[model samples]
Target chain A: MKLEKIRPSEITPEHVYLSRRRVLRIGALALGTAALSACGLPSPSPEPTQTNPRVPKDLPTDKRDEFGDPANRWEEITNYNNFYEFTMDKQEVARLAQNFKTSPWTVTVGGLVNRPRTYDLDDLRKFGEEERIYRLRCVEGWSMVIPWLGFPLHKLLREVEPLSKARYVRFESLFDPDQMPGQRLSFYPWPYAEGLRLDEAMHDLTLLVTGLYGHPLPPQNGAPVRLAVPWKYGFKSIKSIVRIDLVEEQPATLWNTVAPHEYGFYSNVNPNKPHPRWSQATERRIGEPGRRRTLMFNGYERQVAALYAGMDLMKNY
Target chain B: MRVWLRAHGLQALVHIGALIPLGVMIADYAQDRLTVNPIQELTLRTGKVALVLLVLSLACTPLNTLFGFRGALRVRRALGLYGFLYVVLHLLVFTVLDYVGDLALIVQTVLEKYYIVAGLAAFVLLVPLAVTSTRGWQRRLGQRWRALHRLVYLAVPLAVLHFALLVKSLVGRPEPLLWGALVLGLLALRIPAVRRAVARWRDRVRHTTSEWRVANRKWRMANSK
Candidate 1:
């Protein structure tokens, strides 16, 4: 089934379209206006506050407004996680992951890089922060809009300095069977792995997330650090990342290795593509009323489309 | 105590124990604590409970046959009814909560997913068994009741396979495989040849052990005297 291309205007408010630039601009204007008003003139203009600058934008899809609150609650976001390292049960994973220690963590960034270096959790925190609310669509046909706080992944990639030979970026999760009980079972060959093409990894939307909803990331939701590839399936955003390897070849990911027919290396969220076990035409947003038609690349097509331009999405998927 | 439980409280105990999971699920729904996808959660939990209870009910016949537990036979009907109740709830949750009464979507889903077909088959097979569970029907059907009730044996394996298929992979999950093994074991024990073989082995072990003990005691007494 063909899905009509979703216009940016349909999903985003006009002001929200340039929110990063406009909000900062408005903040500066508001500050300048406040300064002007303090100096005092008889005639005063209306404050920017009245313009509803801080009011949250309605989420993508017309249904979001109809449903009122589109974003999944913080509790639901934190608790309902699919960290198979802990357990498969959505509710049990949070409690199980809580037992694992995320502090004193270090990620080794090596392989085909010009300047291979290890970054501790504290080192990662020093790269600065940005709060981005992105829609996460799981291959299993459920989605959540999460406000994640992290810097762009390219910042770290630049610091590491990828060589010309490095064509793919492989991510590896923490592999401790004692802490991650699911590792005890040979589920996905322990230390869950995910990879992306160099261009895809360098996308601005790809984030090395540290927190969500203005709070530190919960253990179940990949605490301390994880990748957020908004344009792809949730599994593409590997959790509890411990290693980043810039490789010449596309690294074998856990899901792709487990089920090559169902999960692909590029598991981009494509509504046209149906998973072997289930349909991907629509997804039920957590804490929402009903399913919405899934958009190509999970509605990040405008930003990430050029990366996959001239490539066959169906075959790659 | 065994006789009292057999004649009186066994059915009550089974009924109460089986209802606890359903009560917990209902309480979770009422409290708005039924996970993120409550519909899916409710559907899965109800389906699992039904499968587990169906297996438990099937085990009752083997329990009576192999272990001579008359109490197990007494509560078998209640167990089967509870299983049927959960199956009905499972169907309701899938239709009303998950699909929102979209019969077309349900039909599409059934066609697309083999697990759904397996589950439906199990549910359909149980309907006849449940209808004939009454004492009046049992008498009316006479010997045919036993033949009809044998459908449950087929239904249970299909239910387990449905669960296995629903997960998409049984490699990581042991619950489905364990349930399948249990049903297979129970069914194997029902075969007259297997049952006689087990009984003969058990009898031989018991006789030899007692004989050995008697000889040893006599030898000890003679030596002491």
Candidate 2:
């Protein structure tokens, strides 16, 4: 019973055999992961191009005011959006809103306004662009510093010339369900409405944003035109405006209409007044590792506090 | 190989399936695929997996009662512990990552948020069950172990409620409700009357099949002779 001597070539090297096993394990795991991920987990979206081709390489920026926080990366700001018009999933919004039509867009400014004019995207842009870096704090306890490009809403409001009867300014988003799938959901009072007091709407800090990071606003970030009320929660800054109505009474906003108790009409970024579901004391700044203390009026108290001077924010909230 | 698979396959499947999500999560983290808000992503993923495993664990008895799938019983403990593991991970992500180990914030959240309270309750309830899952404790505890494990009935619903209440919009989000429905159905199946009815139906089907098999065998034997 003589055992046959094995050739060097016949036997697999220890490292080779081990590596083969490792590869097999990895392959199996990867296959399983892919299958499971396909079940629901969001896949990374494709790299996006500059949303608007006509946007300039350089724009006149406001260099005076300093918040000291770095603006979130373009990808972070664009990819993570709460454009429920497209989808509830923040990451999916960018992908879903890729083909959204913002051209030939007209925003009608009417109710209780003297001019009662419908301004096209071109007409709105004539107000001229200024790069204003502002902190956008979401009601969901997330914050982002974004360099927004557009003029103040007050400029547009002044041109429209609000009547004395006009107390609240209501903004409505584009409501085409064919394009905005989330609008199809019957629960949300659709056309995604948001409102601001006349004073708040006319404030210098209240920007009617058209672009961000030197590029025309991406659809997910509210393309063509949107509002950026830095002092209020991000939702207060309505996206993709289709209508602006100045009425005597407060307008019905989407979130407020949905859950008035949870989402107040005056959803100011107040750390003291906690949301019914989550704490407002701290917010995780997007692209940052840890949570930071949420600021009173989102760190714009000095600028906007005078407007809400006598009013009770806690009661309003 | 088939016989070996038949005896051990379901357990192997449960173990592998249970760990796959954690592996995928780790892979996602390494690859930077956890969306822009990784903490929220991690929290959601871990919470969801925990809820699913816990629900699956709760399904074991109902599965056995309805279908006589004893393999479900064998993996029940493993399913539950995996669920507990995920719950722990979920809490860790929320506290360590999201809250940055800020105990004050965690306390505030747990106190302020009803959903967080519900989730915390579910996790606290599961702790004892996971601790006494071993055969040694099971034997010592005896019938009490079964009683103790019945906390799952409460824990599962609480977990479901936690998920349901946490969602921004309940109308658009049907997952928590679907999971609730599943848990409800599983709970309903555990009713003694329902269990007896299902067991009776199963027995009747088995009895009829065996009778047919016997008759066929007899006919074949007679013809051969």
Candidate 3:
């Protein structure tokens, strides 16, 4: 029944039809693969962001280094690392912290405060912004010229009535393992907390920063909320905070508790005393201007110097 | 002595491979491209490659037994040599780059980091195995050679640990777990019972693939014709 109308030529044509179909199928597949360059395809893309910040010479400048080298875009932006709450590894802190939704974030202020309160991000913003140029020294012996945009910590403290018994302010990072994977490993004592002496907590130089490099803090750089203690090593600048417990005793710090010799509570950038391994006198600038000499109290001696007066910094360190 | 030179030559080539990265790293440092912690990255990369090569190198022994790839015997030496070569490179990068060859820093790292201790122990174990891989050393050691080589099994897990600590956060990417699985799978397959079981499975998979290929070929030819 199938061959009723087919001639000998037509029979060969049907056979040829199958062969042509096969050829067409192969040709289509080849073309499809060529179009896709195979599913496991290769092509051009931006080189992995060796993302050093680059600022034009014309960009308005405020902060400069010890050498009086003007801070460029990278120094201001790229160098202000957020390896605090999550991982100390800069790249991993950036990568692993993508899921941290800064919305609904509220800094729960408790402890010595006479009026305990939870200030959501929006309410905190009403406090306004001030751009303070300061040097940020890292525990790993790197530094950056950061013109931080945030209100003074003194202003934030004024909001809540203090408990007279409270002598130190302890800050805690958001502790969800789902969001902060660095907590999974003992990278830094999980939940990444820090505290300040009462006088130090009320210092004018201390900052509750929400932005840096003139923009809202990128999620990796601790968006919405973080502490910015310019005089101390970068670790003191806790990121993605959730709690602030004012205490009578010096609350345990992650580094000082873990390795006391290397990380002292008085982690003021002292050029005189070296870290357990490396010299503290210098730090890599982490931008176009390259490395520069570190300064005493990260060059904030004029504003924060009175706080550390007469104490043996090396002994405290 | 020529055999000695040949063995050393193989290691030298690997050393050169290891050093090329070092040269690039130094160039990066000079050019202001290297990160603040260049040593950490280099050590992690070297350790990673060492472990992968260790698995790939160990794979040769199993494959030789399974498919009867007799030529793999000569190649196995090179593969094992490459593993040892990479491990030594990993160690060197840690010592020179991380600690700047500081004895004090080395002791601090060993005490502070269990992972570093694991890596140090692994490297220490691999030293004798690498030296004894040579025919002269093997003949010299005799029965002791077999005992020494068995240490490779323990070294693999210690090496795995060396890889794990570098994982700052395993939130989204579970590549570390997969790596752990592969290492564990390979080690488990060495058990006599597991070996017999895997042999049967391998034969089945081999038979299935061959038949599938035949079916595919026939269909293609018929359509073409």
* Top TM-score hit: 2
lDDT of 1: 0.80
Alpha-carbon DockQ of candidate 2: 0.52
After best superposition, candidate 2 residue A71: deviation in angstroms?
0.5
Q: Write the per-residue lDDT of candidate 3 for residues A1-317, one digit (tens) a residue.
A: 22122111212222232233344444445565452222210111222111111121223454565547655453335433556556555665654654456776789998888778999866777788766666677766666666666888888787787778988999888877777665677545677778899888898878998765544555676666888898898888887788988899999987677768777876777877765344465565545332346678877788777887898887986
TM-scores for candidates 1 onward, in order? 0.79, 0.86, 0.58
- Give each prediction's DockQ, rounded to 2 decimals: 0.30, 0.52, 0.05
Q: How accurate locally is residue A168 in candidate 2, as Cα lDDT from 0 to 100? A: 99
Residue-level lDDT tens digits of model 2 in A1-317 = 44343222333322333234344434445565443222210111232121222122223232223667777776688889999888888989987986677776899999998899999866886797787899999999999888888899999899989999999999999889999999888878788899999999989999999877655676789987899999899999999999999999999998898888878998999998977676699999988897999999999999988998899898988
Classified by CAPRI criteria, candidate 2 counts as medium
| Interface RMSD measured for model 1 | 2.0
Q: Each candidate's lDDT (Cα)?
A: 0.80, 0.83, 0.67
Candidate 3: lDDT over CA atoms?
0.67
Rank the models by TM-score, top first. 2, 1, 3
Q: Local error of candidate 1 at B36, Å?
A: 3.0
lDDT tens digits, residue span B65-140, model 1: 7767888998899999999999999998877766677777678768777888898999999999999999999999
lDDT, residue A164, model 1: 95
In model 3, the Cα lDDT at residue A188 comes to 53
Q: Which stretches of candidate 1 lie over 4 Å from their true place?
A: A1-69, A121-123, A276-279, B1-6, B202-225
Q: Which residue runs does candidate 3 get wrong by more than 4 Å? A: A1-80, A83-89, A92-151, A163-200, A203-205, A210-219, A223-225, A230-236, A240-317, B1-33, B69-74, B135-146, B165-177, B204-225
